[model samples]
Target: MEKLLGEFSIGLFFWQTVLFLALLFLLRKFAWKPILNAVNDREEGIKNALDSAEQAKREMENLQADNQKLLKEARAEREEMLKEAREIKNKMIDDAKEEAREEAGKLIAQAQASIQTEKKAAIAELKSQVANLSIEIAEKVVREELSNKDKQVKLVESMLGEATLN
Candidate 1:
């Protein structure tokens, strides 16, 4: 132990401390500034990259919202067009039905008018036939009675006696 203590001399310790101080000073002046500058540059690059990524994310979200709004507007316009088409179709159907009903009414009225005219014509024809038949019957009866002149004179005398002047 005494030998080991003896080896730790003041001169050796002072030289070692001097060398360490010189090395520390040299490293701080020549190496430390460039290394620290490199580290700071790398840190700045990483910060810029992170900021750009955040900006890109915000832009993508805005674009998605715009697309959704456009889709909703398109759907509403399509639905409105469909509703208008349905209204037009219903109106056309109603107009067609009304036209058909009017045509049918006109046809029925024409048929009734024709039937009334034919009935009047038939009644007129029947009356004419009946008048002709009565005239023929009266002529036959007068010819048979007048064939006998004596009987005709006796019939005329009886009619004259029953006749009134007024």
Candidate 2:
């Protein structure tokens, strides 16, 4: 009976080895192959997502740089416009001042000419009045002298004597 049991144990060991080898082959063919493929696909998906995130980050940085450049340009343009406005303001002020000075000079000149004309007119009027007064005074003196008939006759004879000598 011990000999038969030993022989039966050898047959059992043989059957167990065959079943274990068959199970390992079936798992490799169905379960292990599918699981490895699934893990590889997930790894690829993760890698692609990380790549997209990196690309998005780079694009955002580029956009920010572009915005900064545009801002600088805008600030420069504003400064240029302000500078032009200030220059125009200054030019306008200078022009206005110059025009005012010219206008004032013209006014002064016109006033002086007007004064000179008035002075000349007043002197002419004074001379005419003096001439008229002198004429009136001479006429009065002659009338008084002529009021004496004897002196008038003597003056007439002297005038007639001078006329005959010519």
lDDT on C-alpha atoms for all candidate structures: 0.87, 0.92
Best by TM-score: 2
Runs of candidate 1 with Cα error greater than 4 angstroms are 1-30, 134-166
Provide TM-scores for the models. 0.60, 0.65
User: Residue 8 lDDT in model 2?
Assistant: 83
Candidate 1 lDDT, tens digit per residue, 1-166? 9999988899989999999899889988888888898899999999999999999999999999999999999999999999999999999999999999999999999999998889888888888887688658746765787899987787677757856552
Instruction: Report the number of clashing residue pairs per model.
Output: 0, 0
Tens digits of per-residue lDDT for model 2 on 91-132? Answer: 999999999999999999999999999999999999899879
Point out where model 2 deviates above 4 Å.
1-21, 133-166
